[model samples]
Target: MTVPGYRNVPAQEWDPAAPADPAEAEEFLRLCYTEVSRLGPVEPRLAVVRAQIAATGTYVHTTDELVWGARVAWRNASRCIGRLYWRSLTVLDRRRVHTADEIFRLLVRHLQVAGGGSAIRPVISIFAPARPGRPYARVWNEQLIRYAGYRTEEGVVGDPRYVPFTDAMRAMGWPGRGGPFDVLPIVVEVPGESPRLFELPEKAVVEVPIAHPELGWFERLGLRWHAVPAISNMRLRIGGVDYPLAPFNGWYMGTEIGARNLADPDRYNLLPVVAHGLGLDTSHEATLWRDRALVELNRAVLWSFHRAGMKISDHHTESERFLAHMRNEEKAGRPVPADWTWIVPPMSGGATPVFHRYYHEADQRPNFYLDSEAAALARGAGVRPALAAAPLAA
Candidate 1:
């Protein structure tokens, strides 16, 4: 397939019947950002990468496995195509590998000079544990410094919600720390039809108060469409169940969404992102962006892996366990309502945290973080604007 902006790289073919590569197994990382860059400086090298990447089920083991090759491709392609027009230093002057976050820094710079609206979205997936921002972040980040055009030590930017330099962002931007990549937020639709269903599919997930007056009900659920339970004629209802689950049709990003996901919490927080603000007609020019969603989806898939490299992260909420306690409150019929607190899974107990560190090599050099978008935004943009329209808490 011709990926317009980029030359083709070797893509791997998959055998569904065969076992998956151990690296790509269990966890999946999306290297969406580096796809265009993977083509090499030479036409032939670009072809090799194009062929390798074209495969359907290529597995990503480390962040290196995911992005280095792609960055190398871009470095190689620089000889002829957009090189002369570029206003910055050449990547060949610097020889190093880059991490997803670093790539993002460069991507912002690329946009600053290239002036493309949103062609450069990248995602990464990490299958293990690693620190979010330490010196090592440089290892994967070095490659970025080479290709990214401008320079100014500006703290990680590209605020899709608010253009940092824009007077609008400075004058009326929320949280007011303009990012160059700001795009108006879009609001997706939430139907008023019957939403709660039972026997959710394997992908079905829910989030609820850890300490609610009415216990037993979970908070939120993020599952794949395939995971939804087979609804029967009887299962349908207006609302109100012990679990009080809400159905959503969207993404449960594994690890490919990358720095875009990180900048998110820094941008407007995570909840709003999950709500799909890209669709709000009054907010964003989403339709104009609709055509390339596949490319966006591809970026999302790849960026997820980069985000995963930060460190093992999770929602870490005490709300659910407290929900059971809250149930006891109502059972005793206590008039006083319980206050909320940050939820942390008890490590001593049998509870195994989703964000534990992963020792990638024999040296025990910790790499990757098991982060989820739900945790980053803390409650899908919180229980504010989207809540009133959203179903009331059970």
Candidate 2:
């Protein structure tokens, strides 16, 4: 969904059955108290949540806390380059939801709302949290919108990163049309059931077909990307509480699509293809073919999204905004934790402001995290095999 560091982090060994980390939970409550109290006394509500945490070893966030916590989580996401707009996140509280079907339905709405028309908005939908005895629901899509990867004799077709997950979906009985640009269906798994694949309604998805302003051949590559980058598989861990089904999105920074997704060898791997198309000298490492193609792909992504009237930002502008965000956080006496490798754009890193400075890498709480189990699930491993055949929800 989100790259681990992007939507992924190194897998931290954790027992799903273990109780909430008391110290972490307490710290989270303190944060909630401090933030919520700034609005009003709200001491009574805080007292109740505290008492519940004491009794049950867990507690529910009030509507205000959930909303604020989600926003704060974005602010605390170490790898996000778009933290400049953290406070603008729209939180949709669906913590009551536990079923695969309902989550699928809400995800459709999330896509429609976030990517509907050309109005790109940042939104997060928080679903049920993982507790001591209950298994949390999980979405298998690394992102809400992704192309299906089909394994062929010639090699993997489509996005290679998702080939395993795509196979897993097919094995689970999803009838996805195998094509290079086919939008993968959303697969949701509950603790006790088979993962269900829900097809995204076409109308809800807005895609930008890649085309270069000068290179006419670019459009013939048949490459297209979804306008919204809704990360669906990661957990939003706040105050020691784990919400495993919080799917959040922001508009893309052109480099993410152009440099990483489309150019990375493990992904669409289009650099060599584009370089060949451009008739570049690929004989030597110094030809800078990769660098040149990367720039063109990034250019095409920005142009395509712009032409389609979808929201997108160039790496240069995003990097500048991130610096402004850092200054603002400093003014507020908050240390912004950032991963320099991730904060800088994938292409032309040295040219961006973010690449010139060091950042605090200390992790902050109320941030999105990816666990080993969720990572495996995203790879298309069946839940029944992994969870000892937990009963499927009928």
Candidate 3:
């Protein structure tokens, strides 16, 4: 099946029934072993992988190989600006997990492991890889922690992006609280069984109440956001193998919450509210009232997260770290493939150093990918009949 590309990246069509490409496997093994000197030699591992693929169409990754593959995938993520900490990622191998109940329990554990303390760490839980011509399991939520959006007579009560998903959840028997910041349930679907909804415990979700450092009235708005940004739907590809149920997370970049999630018209749309609170003249767009409100909203997000002792990075700091990552990779004689559009921060593009330069754009392997089917599922589009009958591969 054809897996659509993310943004400007080219699409990669993968056939689930097709055998793993021997060349891709060899290249990945060679690279992995060569880079990690302690891994010893690749020849023995290569022979074993070749024989395994010849016998079963795919090869399993050893624990060390799986961990290194996940770390390399983060390093190859073209859109991520926090690649500097790729090596520090915590990879949780959950390949033995299959049932929805077990998956849900582990998912909650994943959240607790990643965001349990004040400092959030990068974590990825890799489940069983898809066998050739077999249906795989996956989570339907775009992120592990997202607020539900209900369409009301007034307007969208929560995040508008999730209204359709919320509707789908309700259809599947989820009794939502109908509040502005109600955390959505985790939808886990196993191979043959129907999708199941598991609500996250209050202890599993770490939230920060947004309040501006200067504006005393800002806390009255009751705006808040989850501390960890755990993306649950993306497929993880490594060494010609696909793991459909791998969910990974990193700490928040302030602009992600401030400039896009909160400021976007379709999202919380909080700029106007903040502007009105600031008493800025909204008479004309030229007055830069929106810009001023956006800055304050971002400030409130950063300050609130900091006050809550939550790990978060400002766009400026992240941009600088990305450049440092590029330099480190270059010194190691490796090309840093990056998408310019995603590398630049959402707000204050010109002010950031990443906006001024060009980056090499390439579809690198051993990277996380968002398949079209997975994206649709995250949007609450229940499994299509055609896709269910003939499942797509990552």
C-alpha TM-scores of all predictions:
0.17, 0.92, 0.95
**What is the Å distance of residue 179 in model 1 from its true position?**
14
The model with the greater TM-score, 1 or 3, is 3
Winner by lDDT between candidate 3 and candidate 2: 3
For model 2, what is the alpha-carbon lDDT of residue 83?
89
For model 3, give the 10-residue run with minimal summed lDDT.
385-394
Off by over 4 Å in 1: 1-104, 110-371, 378-394
lDDT to native, each model = 0.23, 0.83, 0.90
Q: How well is each residue in 1-394 modelled by candidate 3, as lDDT tens digits?
A: 1223545444665667777889989989999999999999889999999999999999999999999999999999988999999999999999998898899899999999999999899999999998899999999999999999999999999999999998887777777889999999888889887677788988899999999999999999999999999999988889889998899999999999999999999999999999999999999999999999999999999999999999999999999999999999999999987877788999999999999987777677899888888888899897444333321111
lDDT of 2 by residue, 244-341 (tens): 88999999999899999999999999999999999999999798888888888889999998899999999899999999999999998999988887
Residue-wise C-alpha lDDT for candidate 1, range 148-259, written one tens digit per residue: 1111276434433322212221222223223332222211111232111011111112111111122112113121111111100110011000000111111122221222
The alpha-carbon root-mean-square deviation between model 2 and the true structure, to one decimal in Å, is 3.6
The stretch of ten residues in a row with the least summed lDDT in candidate 2 is 385-394
Candidate 2 residue 114 C-alpha distance from true site, Å: 0.6
